[model samples]
Target chain A: MRHLLPRARRGPAFRAAALALALAAVPAAAQEGFGFGEPEAEAAAALPSAGPASGASVGGELSFSIDAFYRAEDEVADLPFEGLAEGVLEFKASGTKVEAFIKLKLSENILGESPEDMLDEAYLRLYLGPHSLEGGLLKLVWGKADSQGPLDVLNPFDLRDLRITETLERKIAEPMLHATFALGDFTKLELAFLPGFEGHRIAAEGPWAPAQVEALELLGIDFEGYLPDTEGLEYAQAGLRFTTSSGPVDWGLQYFYGRLPTPAVVFIPPVSLSLSYDPYHQLGLDAAAVFAGFNLRAEAAANLTEDLEGDDPEVYNPSLLWSLGFDRDLFGGINLNLQGSGSFRLAEEGVGEVAYDIEADTERTRTRVTAILSQKLRNETIEWELRALYGIEDADFYLLPRLAFDVGDAEIEIGAGIFGGDEEGELGQFAESSWARLLLSYEF
Target chain B: MKRLALLAAVLAAGAASLGAQGALGAEEIVRASRDRIQADTVSSRSRMMIVAKDGSATERLVDQYSLDAKEGKRTVIVFQKPASVAGTRFLTVSNPGRDDDRWIFLPSLAKVRRIAGSEGSGSFVGTDFSYDDISSSDREVEEDTHAILREEKLEGKDCWVIESRPKDPSFQYTRMVHWIEKGSCIALKAELYDKKGLLKLLEFSQFKEVQGRITPMATKLSNLQANTSTSIAVEILKYDEKIPAGVFTPRYLETGRPQ
Candidate 1:
């Protein structure tokens, strides 16, 4: 059997640093003493009394799920059944001048796979008059769009499984220092610096691995994935953003210096290939407004990669990316959200670059459109939704339909993913990975 | 006999003139009743109970900060309970001539989103109260024309029954009737009517004096068509608190902290 393998793992020291960053937030919260206050009990005690200006709380959620799939092709060795359990523990505290939050995710596959436990986010914030300073492992969202925005580049994504597509669920937080200063009435200036670097988390040696890796192995070639070195200061990223409001519209201007998280293939002689991340600079603009009962969001960014002239075959070319979308309520309480995004490659005459091309079909402009329709019934206890994504240039599409209902403090959700179109398209590669899922979760 | 007749006619004319003037006084009474409590700032923590049609209810803890700014009234509300909606914040700033500006931050979204002002009639987080109902206490007096319907005794207290019709055709309610306590100027009860007749009923009770100001500590809004009701009982209430100016901005809504 052929397999795609990762050539690197983060060192123990880096793990310790991550642990320390998470642990450091505990003391700030511990000073106030952790209390598991029952929300119902606290709210029932309606007393007119003055309480302390500081407090701490601990809470979490636990969920279990089962997934089943039907295979149509032998893309990879098929195992149709999987079971998993996940938990999230969170600690939060706030004082008159300081606040802290820490959250951790614990997951275990009941099928006997190794557990994947990680810190979701841990941050300490200090308030100084009209300004604030926060530091720790954090996930900073920068764009105004509802999803898949062009300017939301601060965090790397976890793409090990294509089934998980929620924006917050897919983001991988990084260590950073973020500060915001109030600039008059409806304006703010924000600055952020990430001291270390990390890239997207992709699975190795599985049906969920990148399709390129699997196709190359089928043709008698070896594929390897390399993690970027995090020890150097050269990999650090920094950004600045200015946000303000004019009339009913809110807009922001941002500039960032960072490495693109997407992996690019580098051809090694003697029938070898490796994936690497390339450095890039991005200047972006985002705006949001409500017009005639519709919420409209737009974001545009100019990504200047190392291959500005598009002459280097190994490096990805510079591109202009934009997204426009609107959210509105239609036909009673049902909501409809639509977004269209496009990326236009600059100097597209490059010799060796393929976006969705397994057969060397390079397109200068790639467009994708997404739509989501959702409704809540029975006092918001029952939720039904349908989400669709279509790649215009690649002629591929993905559809997800879900139904969720609440019963006695527990929510049960059943969903299915369907993929179709050209086999070489980005989403179509997962045609065989399409699956149905059932999840039951409870929160306290 | 002619002199006696003239006296009766003069008395009748005097009564008609006074009745005509009484109609003009209704607007002032409404203006005074709505603006009864004058405070520079208000901060409070309250428990919201959303009762379903089946009588099962859920509670949500909320913190609210409000201030009368130079531009207009500004208010912020933060949710701290139910786990699912914790850390959700909303900010609304009233504009003089245009529609108000509103923004909301959802923990799941992790960013502040601008919402349209036309959602005034939408339900407030699955509650019976609408977005306009939350800010109805601060509605401008001139927006609606009011008339004194009659004087009646409600719960052994004299109240002026007034009928109000909004000038803006787009208002969620076609007309409303309010029962205002005579001396306190507090609206004890109100019935809102839509195009399809009676829609909802609102009642305010549990009057208390905080910082020498008469405040209602309990409020309930019931949707007649849905057979559901939401009640908010204040756990802690304060008046004229020192709320920072930065607390009303979108930044505070996103961060859940001042500035």
Candidate 2:
């Protein structure tokens, strides 16, 4: 874990104060109270008693948004780590029959690497009588989980340039065809077909791959790039999701037959390693219900892969995952969400793999608890959010807190991320990755 | 025509038989108010201002398309705003005997999400209006028992003050009161009382005749306890507008047009 852990970027309180000052620089309107939601759009009018009838509108809406942010880090291990700058520009438009969206992200290291440009999403959608068909690059999300769910599988996420925390938006969109049909008033059926597969843009080679790779190397586990010859059309993917709501409850049943997002690194003795994404079938169920001002959601999935018996230590076994969560608003404009999730491996006992002890084989059942508390003020123009992820079984946790102020179309905020726990725990392994940042963005 | 004639006959006989004592039932008053402005289709755009107790105000722009369906009314609302809420759309289909079906498309999610029944009590995008509040205007007239409380003069016009109590004990509002213009039968004011007492007051004004149709162009909902208020000002309104047939479906929520 130590060798694979990404070194943390730390900074002094002075840097944090500087970021805070920058955040407070925005001028606020002289008003007493605030609320949240779409502030730009408004409605009201005095209708004409009688006048010429207005013609139907066949045109659409068009808008462009620009967002940029900078963050300063704290000192880590007596060394100064430069911060980062990020920028994104998006163009969107949707008519009665068509929809289009495109976005580009630019990332740069304050003291290091050059700016890198990424094409985030470029997609178009069409509405066809009770059915919707979308093609081009698409980001598809499934499941009703508050946080990440084992069932919310579709887009393989690439790490955010500034991966300070985890969010569902980390998804990487790829070319695919998505169709949704309304079975009736209360039900919907969705289908997705992928001509090709897109695996996670996870770590591969050298120094930038995080220090943890060295430990794996010490254990004779070496990782290689994707097999160039395996990029054939046979490796496609498809998925189906059926959703319905009755009374107070909403639920969805989904199925997907595709290769896993993360590849399993095959270990064949010293100085040898290769990567392969094992094909698997997954069955998922998700539901959400609101009661007493609280929204409760649950998601569960059973995966079938190569190693059902679990005896083959090298090949990962089938897995089972479940998540339960709730969201509610409390006094003082505060919203709180909490979730408990667990993952289990389905493997037969005594199925014999002697290379490593069962305890250290990395096949143990894991559980975690996560929470998000957010408060809004001045009508929702100013919001402060705190998120925490705790590994229940490993006793490790990570905390991220931020303050954001929305000035019309622009926003500014500064905050720090904290990580602590057992070195063996998931988040604890990145204890040193704690960093503080300031963000600013504008939409037009 | 038959229903109106029957209603007129009933009113005339009641006026004679119970001259001093009001004979108008709660259901009749409500039905009259609900049907005062009748059209096959309705389309309008308006500006809304939400004011906080401290006097701060925010504005929103929206367009609404309402079509009369066999079961009830189907309405689609699209936010045309400063930008934050732009491209957001909401569709609600009325169900006569049961609850309505509602769906929303948030620009942020880029997908349509079905709103569950439990969410009906929640606020409508941070506004004073709740999901239930918006649909309550078309709520089944029979769901509650209505009775005319008194006949009084309001603003120099004869008016019927009515009270209604829901058949369901667990309804959000314990009781409701309405001030309906006697001749026009248009509800000019309403008050909702919850368990804690007086909750809200909704007022309709800016009465105008559109193509022989009487329409209230403005509405203000005030939250008594919260000291917050929201007012809707209709900017462009037209009756019997030829709205695209597809506007009533969920596809219209996401694509802005129906197939």
Candidate 3:
């Protein structure tokens, strides 16, 4: 990975080129009609009352936005070992008949030796009276609860982090079909499906004796018997979500299942562990509530798997995770958010007894508390935000502070973080690392 | 003949009483309407329903606005509803005569855009309300002539009926009738006529005191010919904050985000 650095220097330049290409790809009509579905328009138009005699035509809305960040990390342990920069562009248009969205992301490794990966999303949506169909890379959210499993698109302030790992990896670019039927003002049924790749896959292979190689056996077990084959793997996930809002309270519940593929691996002799591919099952729950200026959210997920291979005797290991957070507006634009979560593996097994025993206590727990002081400097422009985060875990502690400035179509920020811990367990020695970063971004 | 004369006298007296105690006087009412039309700073949100003549409806959330008193200068922001735009923000500022300057800060985009403006009366966001309806916050009353039409009770509230005819042919509406509240000086209802003197739009609603000032709390605007309507419900209202003056500047319009 270190040898790939020299070529990575071109990452930013490539991203810039991609951005330019995307901009050029847009039609002239769209560029001219920017800010069509804006909040200001909604606020202005909503000032009027709803009276039976009033004859006002409902208005349409359109908007375009972009955000980017750059960072430099120093000597961070067990973290991405490279300087990072990321950019996201989004566009939306809404009318009485249709709504659409487009988004793209360009990420680069500044310090490492390889080109950064890029993620792009584009989708067109059509509203057909009672149903809607959207195609292209899109973020599909299912569920009604505010803070726990899904339906957390609103209220950015209550988010644990800007990025949610599970959802980010599940973002699919293929075309998807979705439909919704009104059950009532408080309940609706939603169904969606897409044709795409499954989460991950694993394969098996081995070398044997010349003539009888095909008939070889391992520890009285048939090497080729009952082995699963990997091909044309399809990933599918479906769930039912219900949402109801009464006064200031909103709630949601959902259930979903999908297969995940891990990287392929080779097993050695002494530890006789065969690399078998299997789908990991996940169950999740989420919820949130708001009262006055205080808000609370909680979510939990459990991973269930029974065996690594059918012929090989091995016990299944399961993991459970949960997170909780709270937020309050102290005054003005200043706000505070405190969040924490724990990831625990209930069972652990490996190729050898030594490996299995070592993995038994892999349960990890982490907590983070953050404070943000914000000010609306000039109406909607020139917003200044100062933020600080204190993160603590069983192995280490981290302190991070950042400041961001929004200037017209450009945004810039600078920040630094420090990680510290004493060497004790296997994870502690690696956790005693710290780094600082600076970021600058612009959008058009 | 005697009964007819008596009836005319009674109608005249009823009209007189409606005009005398209504919210705003005829001249003052016009002045307030003009003040809103020509307001240098205004911010509000609206829920719009686009209804086709065939009876099809598209409902959505629209954040409309304008900044600065200069002609062709304003800002407008729209939030995507049902998901993304629940708390989205947008802004627009008009440039001289070319087009109104515009910008939108999206949760997805997290930035803004400067859009060119064209045809003030063109459909706004595919709804019946034209760009003119959004920018109408600052029109001068002198641009139109005012006449007391009659007095009547609208939506169960006593109102003063007044008619206005545009002095400029370029004005989108040829005439507008307002039902001003006798006690609050607020326009409780209004009827807009096209150049041919045909009714084109109707507006009516109620007002609530916000921050010590009477302001429209709910309003509905319907395009009669188009057979569609836009409605607004204010979920939150705040006033007289120390909002920086620069927040309304074109530069600010291009970058402001809720902190």
Candidate 4:
């Protein structure tokens, strides 16, 4: 069980690509989370007599977006130009809901490698009272906020580069069951469970494997020839959130816990890969407040996990990780956001330190800072935003600038970004890269 | 008719002395109340409880509001209850000296229906209070002639009692007596009368301070004839945020979502 961690970490690109396809195929008609529009007093007027009975109400919204980018690299690795497109459809009836999503990668011209092109993300949802059942391929949201940390099920997209990160691409959707209950005026409780099954499970030797060894080549990560077959996995999560208002102060707090399965295979001599499953635990908290022209939001999460072997080891010990961030409005529509997070390995034999020497029990921390300026045109429908991010651990900086224009029923936007960092294998060699893209979306 | 003459004589005497001292004079009090009502338009989240004649009750969360004088044309946006009218956006535009123009955006039907002014006197959203009661933000000062009644203490708060008679016979209420807070100039209570001089509805509640402005944050309006009442509590008050002008447009109401 412990030996499969390296392999699981190797193949992120394939996973990311697959997740993207799935997201695109998702229908736009799915029920969005909570939303409230401005309220007005009812007119002091009488209504006319009732009309003929109409059938039950039904409606939905759809969105489609595509990203294209080109990169100039010294050695031109596997891919330099990539194109991605995604579409979503959502519908609701009798308060019941259904959604479908699809994601596709049209072309990738890199260092000359053409993989089997494909489709991703197909699922459906049904709501019965307090319970919602989901099937096919689906992304599950867990925790109070920031599903990215340890329980993220969806791939994270990089709009400027038209690419999704390799690290986050491996999250896949399986059949799941979810439920929500109103705790009170200011609070709600939700729970979800997912059971692992055959067709959904990735086999160690199948042509379409969960984690492909070849995909990890770019990251310089390699796993020993041992291929582990996973039997199944199970996940459960719960969250509670509450909101309250007193005078000008409005605020809320949320807490969540998720336990997710991590499947791996280990091949012993003369025997095919044997599947073993380990689960990871995640806990998170989120809080927000709005007053005057100011808004504040903050979130944090911690991941807990144990090595597959019950006994403690020394070299590559597992660790608990946490992340936190805050955002505030400066003036007009301008806002400032700052975030920092780090991971620390708990002291254990044969696990805590390997490649780098460390104190028997020590914590490693990474931090990042970002600043953004946003402005809303007084009488116009256009808005603009500029942002910059600096990563402390990697000593890298990224700049993102975007402009959005409202055009009747749709919104059109253009954006550009640049990233500068130290080159790989070289201590002080610096490098820089940039990309740009455009997007159009409509809501009904 | 003779009783009306006697009441008029008494009001004249009260006005003459009150005007001479200029201390909370009848005219001054009425002017202050009108000015306060016109100062700011408020958007509030209200929980409305409707009690029926049989003592049964229904509760709903209503997003109700009015734009301040600065907002120019009077506008109101009412959100429908989650169960019956979820996604319903209703808008009413009031024109001076004329009946307000009304439209209801039904999300279920995806259509905007204009409401005739004749229907304005009907109960609002199944509550005992008429829609007129809800949109009376700009009730003209001259529409009702005010006569300072007296100084009194009600519900542990000091108030000014004043009688107001509708200048227009078409107005639903014949006369209304208001309890106004001397400091905030907000009407803390009101008693409505029918054309026959019979008590009709009673409204009373103190103004709660929200975002530096004093407003009637909670109100209890009772219908004497129907033996029913509605109590509304407004929470989470925010002022002057960048709300899209489209949010107030008729198109937005019908869609239930802003563009």
**Best-fitting candidate, scored by TM-score:** 1
TM-score to true structure, per model: 0.86, 0.73, 0.47, 0.46
Q: What is the interface root-mean-square deviation of candidate 4?
A: 19.7
lDDT of 4 by residue, A155-235 (tens): 222111212222223344444554444343223455555443211223222112223332332234434333333234543
lDDT of 1 by residue, A297-355 (tens): 99999999988878777777889999999998885578899999989988677645543
Choose the strongest candidate by DockQ. Answer: 1
Question: Which lDDT tens digits does candidate 2 get at residues B52-128?
Answer: 87777777777777777677777777887746677788776766666556567876665565553334445556667
Off-target runs (Cα >4 Å) in candidate 1 are: A1-52, A72-79, A95-97, A110-117, A205-207, A217-230, A268-270, A352-360, B1-24, B167-170
Task: Count clashes in each candidate, considering only residues at least 3 apart in sequence or on different chains.
Answer: 0, 36, 83, 57
Q: Locate the minimum summed-lDDT window of 10 residues in model 1 chain A.
A: A29-38
Per residue, candidate 1 scores C-alpha lDDT tens digits across B199-230 of 99887777776777666678787889888888
CAPRI quality of model 3? incorrect
lDDT for B154 (candidate 4): 72
TM-score of chain A of 3: 0.58
How far out, in Å, is residue B129 in model 3?
26
Give candidate 2's iRMS in Å, 1 decimal.
Answer: 7.4
Query: lDDT of all predictions, in order shown?
Result: 0.73, 0.63, 0.43, 0.45
| DockQ category of candidate 4 | incorrect
To one decimal place, how large is model 3's interface RMSD in Å? 19.3
